[model samples]
Target: MTQTTEFDWRPFLLRWSGEWSDWSDSRSDDETRSEGDEAARQGRWLGFPPASEERIVAMEKRLGRQMPPSYRQFLKVSDGWQHAGGFVWLLAGTTDARWHDNESGLADMFEEDLDEDAGPDERRDAEIWRRGLQLEVESDATYVLMDPEDVDDDGEWAVYTWAGWRAAPPERYANFAEFMRDMHREFHSLRAHRTEGEPEFANDTTRELDALVEKARLMALRGEWERAGRTLDEAKEYGRPRAVGLGDQIRRLLGQTYMVYFEDVVTDPRYAPELLPSLVAEHAAHSYRDDSTLMFHLRGAGDDVVSSAYATLERVRDGTYRYTAAGPFGEAVERARELARWGDTDGAWRTLMDALPLWQPLGPDHLAPMGWVADPLLGPLLTPDRGRELLSTPRGGQAGEAPARSAGLDADNLTWLADPDAHDNLTSYRFVLVEGVAPEDLPGRLADGDEAALDDPMTSDEARRRSLGGQREFSSYDDRALMSVGRAGDRWSFAFDGDPAHFDPRRFVSPAAAAAAAATAAGAGARAVVVWSGLRTWRGNPFFHLSVARDGAERYAFTYADAEIHRTGEIPRALDPDRFFGSGSGKVEGEGHAEAERSLLEAVTGEFGVHLPRHAITNGRLHTFTSRSWTRAPGNGETYAVISLNLVRE
Candidate 1:
């Protein structure tokens, strides 16, 4: 006969499940007797064949060490539960090994003595005993059943406890190669339930590890790199033994966070300096690569970041940035540098002015260079004269003209009159004249006396009335002369018809001194002087020739009448000697002859008390002459006709 090979099912049975017990003494009479009888009738549970006395004795002899009472009792019982294609066994037993009693039999005591009530102290001791028993159970249960092919049937079984039931495939693998294979196969099916399944098994260390891995992935989605890295760290700490390839996961997340932090810093450009060091340190601690480029950009050792940013802009010219929006700081810095180089202090000032409206909300440190730029920019815009002008007048409004008096003549009113540029324009000057004594008293009364009369209460309204009264008589000073005088106490009042021309006393003391002499001659109180000057014609002279335009021998000629100043002397001399004279001849045709002549006479007489005689030697001729004493050079006493003629030909 051929040699027969017999397969012992014992190893498979032991590997399939933990021990089971019948609870022969402790079970209820109906359930225990029935279930035990049923299991015996069934004949095979976990492939043990039957719990016969002969089998027990054989196992004990083979193993050498006495099996714990719990194991014997468990073998005598019905199988417990089935899972993952195998049965799990529950054992019941007692031990007399005192030291081992706490280690192996504590669970037996709890199961057998259910009616025992212990005091707090006894309860505490029982808890301690239970803890020891738990440790033993865990140790006995610890085994990793490799693939079935790896089990050795002939190996010594003395040191091996029965392998527990295979409940399910382990949720995570300890070996990386196996894990990757499992992950690939389960990747899709496992992912659908991961969010719900992970937390359900969260109390298990292995499940918590899975949960953390998922959490890191979710954080990555939200761009929360820092938080993702921290979650990966926790997963590594808890899942080190069971989490396959977790180290790589953690490393990848840390690297991601490092890059993200650098990107954030570069984009914002405004984080506090104190934060940068901490950020860089975190990246370094994580062993992140690519820090060199970030460090160079932030620390400015290699190609200043601002300059580099500007260099990248294609449309920007001068100091202004265009196209992209990320470079205001770079633009501002470039603008400041350009302003400094070009010496455009005012342009710089304006730039800062424009920037203030834009940058007011920025923090002081960020705005520091701008503030520094403003000082140098503004320095050149201010000067003493400009400062005075700014202080004296409204920024962009009209300035106040000289103030006019209501009654008495105010010397202060003469202040603006001294300006030679003052004209008849309403914007130029304002004049107020006061009248008191009648015009008939001018021959004998001093200007000071007239001024005193003008100050009198009774004469104040009269002075105002008279000053305005002559306004309609003369369109301007050139038309007619206006005079007024008043007196009251020591106040003096004097008025003139037209705008007075003020002469510097230092330059022409004669007129001022003569006026003073006249005032002294009249009285010590006040004085007034009135004079009227008009136009005079000139003689037929070559200098006064009119221009003729040739039009085929039919000439069109026109002559302009001009005015001449005769004498600007004392009042008595101007009126008495008849020394004033002028020359003009022939009919004249000119646009502004009358007005120009009147204006010329008024200008000269107003400046130097002079009047020209009104008489013509011709129908009209444009000629100008002065009295013997009032020549081109008054001191030279040379008198002659002066004219400018133009002739036009087509």
Candidate 2:
């Protein structure tokens, strides 16, 4: 052969093998080997092939994109050496180049290279060597081939193209490009549908829920509580499960609505018979676990709701409904009071009895109304003995014992008695008299002063008057002197020196005045008053003193002197003088002082319902000047006095 240009084919071999390997792998192995054998036989195909250009045009047609020139050149080389393993030698100045193994090819080139120095052109070519086709060249060279009859088998060809060939661009183009286009189309279609379609799916359910709540609120704002409650019921149904925070929000709304409705329904008579029970039941169900909320409903429901609340309260008290002790107990007491007020006394009493165990532990405040069971129509149910018994029993360390005598005197009985006159018919009085005689007669003889001598059966009426008249100016027997008359109602009265200018004996000495005075005195000092009746005689003497003290200090004192005059005929005649005063002393004296005192004391204490101790009595003597003493103690105290007086009335 004529000497061929010494071509260093290493660079060309690398580029050609890399390209051919990729293209051949993209095809089936059978196709690649057949192409290689054909190329081997056709020596012209050993160099760059003319078929590469045709392949580029085919790929362009298949991809619908034009091929770059550089990419066409790269494909040409790839097609030429599709399976010619290493190197291809071209005949000098001719189109034929014989393929040879790389090692042999390089060795022969090195041997030839010793004789000829490398030229600039050769060095430049060496520097430009690239093993694999550039991305743009590969893109132009690639095509996804599928059997025309097996279009449905594109997935197999697509995977094969990605894995076998190193044609990443072709793989991405085939899968991702088509996928993104379909996604875009779908997105546009959805956008258009959203813009044009009726918005039925977006219902105003939330708005309906909100509107219901708002309507309820507006009703509340307008004070139309019943309407508000109806609206809230609607709201509860509307907001059941769908809305966020709906349960809690509706619960609160319903709570307020029901509370207002409960109050209005219970207080307004028109609604009490029908609406109250339903409201209470609904409230109980919703607020069962919440004692404070339950309490709100219980209290708001007022008297008409008592029966229902009583049932619920009984459950709460019985531990069926869990609640703080104070809440249920308070509600129970309130309900009981309501029942009692509405003439359901038995029901009220029974309810209270049921609640007592629970309330007792909660202490006095809870038991306040129960404690009032002793009032009027309710009082007959709570007898005095029962009251004392309840009061005496200890509940939660609170002693139910009777209050101190002083405080007890101030209790409601005496404070709220209806009839003041009825008091005198209730209690009795005992009058003790102390008399002073001449110093010589003090040891054994009772003094017979002018007033005293009037009682002697032998003394003439004239003698008694002259004696009383002679001693009257010198004696301390002025009408102004204070003297305990008798117990009347819850109070004790005494005669006091009235302001002479304002004193009208007719009024001051009147039974009405005396009754008023006694009540005033008792209330002023928180002391129960004791009255003395002159009709009650002690050793033929009608004289008595009444005394009251706290801590042994005298709060009040009164004395009644002169049995024949004051005791025999004082109150009855003072009350209605025209009826009995003209009668003789004997006729009046026959009205036993002891019986009157007994009756008066009983009437007063019974009417007022206060207990008075007998030791609080004090009797003083006339002329001898008996002294009574009192010591101040924190509670009720006793007073002592000597009463020595003799009365003889004409």
Model 1, span 477-557: residue lDDT tens? 121112222221123222232222221111211111122223233344222222222112222221111111111121221
Model 1: how far residue 207 lies from native, Å: 56
How many clashing pairs does model 2 include?
48
Error of 2 at 307 (Å): 45
Model 1 worst lDDT window (10 residues) = 613-622
Best lDDT among the predictions, by candidate number: 2
lDDT scores for all predictions? 0.29, 0.31
| Tens-digit lDDT string for candidate 2 (335-413) | 7554433223345445644454344322211112231321222332343433333333333333233322111111222
Model 1 lDDT, full chain set: 0.29
Give the C-alpha miss distance for residue 576 in model 2, angstroms. 4.8
Q: What does each candidate score in C-alpha RMSD?
A: 40.3, 41.1
Model 1: residues with Cα > 4 Å off, grouped in runs: 1-388, 392-452, 456-463, 466-494, 499-582, 585-650
lDDT of 1 at 370: 16
Which candidate has the top score in TM-score? 2
